[model samples]
Target: MIELTDNAATELKSIIDKEEKKDHALRIFVAGMGCSGIQYGLALDDDVKEEDVTVESKDIKIVMDSDIVGGLTEAKIDFIDTPQGKGFVIDNPKAASECGSGCQGCQ
Candidate 1:
């Protein structure tokens, strides 16, 4: 299950409220491989595919593809505000020692 911290939920809701797309759900999926093994993508989407898993958080619907569920099962989403900027951060324990695609040194 993916968990969103209070700050993440509020921040995401603010962004979603400003989008032009209405009646759409937030789609969070695994994108290309990252330095940590897997990268995630977030978008405003309305299409719920047959293999998608829908999770509700802070009254918002977050959808993810079924195939990525295992890797992101206990992931946590949080918002961070640093001196440089503010953004969303996904803390995925499963990716602690992950290696991205095309990396030959990681196992």
Candidate 2:
């Protein structure tokens, strides 16, 4: 299952509250495919497709396409605020290993 770190859940909740998106669910999707297997993206979405898989973690509802769920199983989503940068990151061991260290996306 896709899991969100505590920090990510907090930050996501804050953003949802700030944006007045109480009715929306966090949507994760396959944004693209490169040498790094698949790139995922997140967004607040109110639309839920018939083929979507929905789950609740840390009180946050997350939706993703059924076909992509297997690749993201056991993935963890975290928010980092280091000096270099700050953003949400999905740590998927399977995807990382598949991508290896050669591609720029993997690096």
Candidate 3:
């Protein structure tokens, strides 16, 4: 249940085309850490674990662990290129804080 902007889809396609692995997918996950408790991660993954989930949108396939699916259903993945360089940008509605949201001892 995630959305990828046109720019993001295009950028991701470009990366996938140039990578050593072509059948892999763009993996996005919520990890425990960041200035704000949880940070978003993006990478290329060749396989999905039993707990992982995936959604296809705008010609892009997004893969995430099923455990994080409920909380991140409406997330948005995008790409941004500037003079500084290029990177992936995430917008998750479920994130209480930018990165460090859940209480350390809690989640």
Candidate 4:
């Protein structure tokens, strides 16, 4: 199952509160075609499809499509703050694959 770091949860909660989507769930899914395979996507949605797998962390409901669940089994969502700015990142071990450019992987 996917997991969210404390900072990630707090940041997401703040966003939801600001956007007034308290009634909605955070939808995380695979989108686009990454060099390795797939990329991640996040959105605020109220509908839970029949093929979705939902997990609750830090009082936040996170939903993901069954098809993409396996690839995110051990993923961790984290929020990072630097002098430049702050943002969310996913530390997904499953996503650590060779980019086909002779490089080890994108870390």
For the record, the alpha-carbon RMSD of candidate 4 to the native fold, in angstroms, is 3.1
Model 1 poorest ten-residue lDDT run: 98-107
RMSD of each: 2.9, 2.7, 4.0, 3.1
Candidate 2 minimal-lDDT segment of 10 residues: 97-106
Candidate 2, 24-92: lDDT as tens digits: 999999888777678899999999999999998999999999999999898999999999999999999
Alpha carbon deviation, residue 63, candidate 4 (Å): 0.4
True-vs-predicted CA distance for residue 9, candidate 4, Å: 0.6
TM-score of each candidate? Answer: 0.83, 0.88, 0.79, 0.85
The C-alpha stretches of model 1 lying farther than 4 A from their native spots are 20-22, 98-107
The lowest-lDDT stretch of 10 consecutive residues in candidate 3 is 98-107
lDDT of candidates 1 onward, in order? 0.82, 0.91, 0.79, 0.86
Clashing pairs in 1: none
- Candidate 2 ranges with C-alpha deviation above 4 Å: 96-107
For residues 1-107, write the lDDT of model 1, one tens digit per residue.
88889999888788877885557887887777656677898878989999999998777788888988888888888899999998888898988575655777555
lDDT of 4 at 43: 84
Error of 2 at 23 (Å): 0.6
> Best-fitting candidate, measured by TM-score?
2
Over the full model, what C-alpha lDDT does candidate 1 score relative to the true structure? 0.82
Candidate closer to the true structure by TM-score (higher is better), 2 or 3: 2
Name the candidate that leads on lDDT.
2
Each prediction's total of clashing residue pairs, residues at least 3 apart in sequence or on different chains, is: 0, 0, 5, 0
Give me the displacement of residue 98 in model 2, in angstroms: 5.5
Model 3 C-alpha lDDT per residue in residues 1-107, reported as the tens digit of each score: 88998999888888888876678888887655655546778888989787788888887777888877787778888888999998888888776764344446545
Prediction 4 TM-score vs. true: 0.85
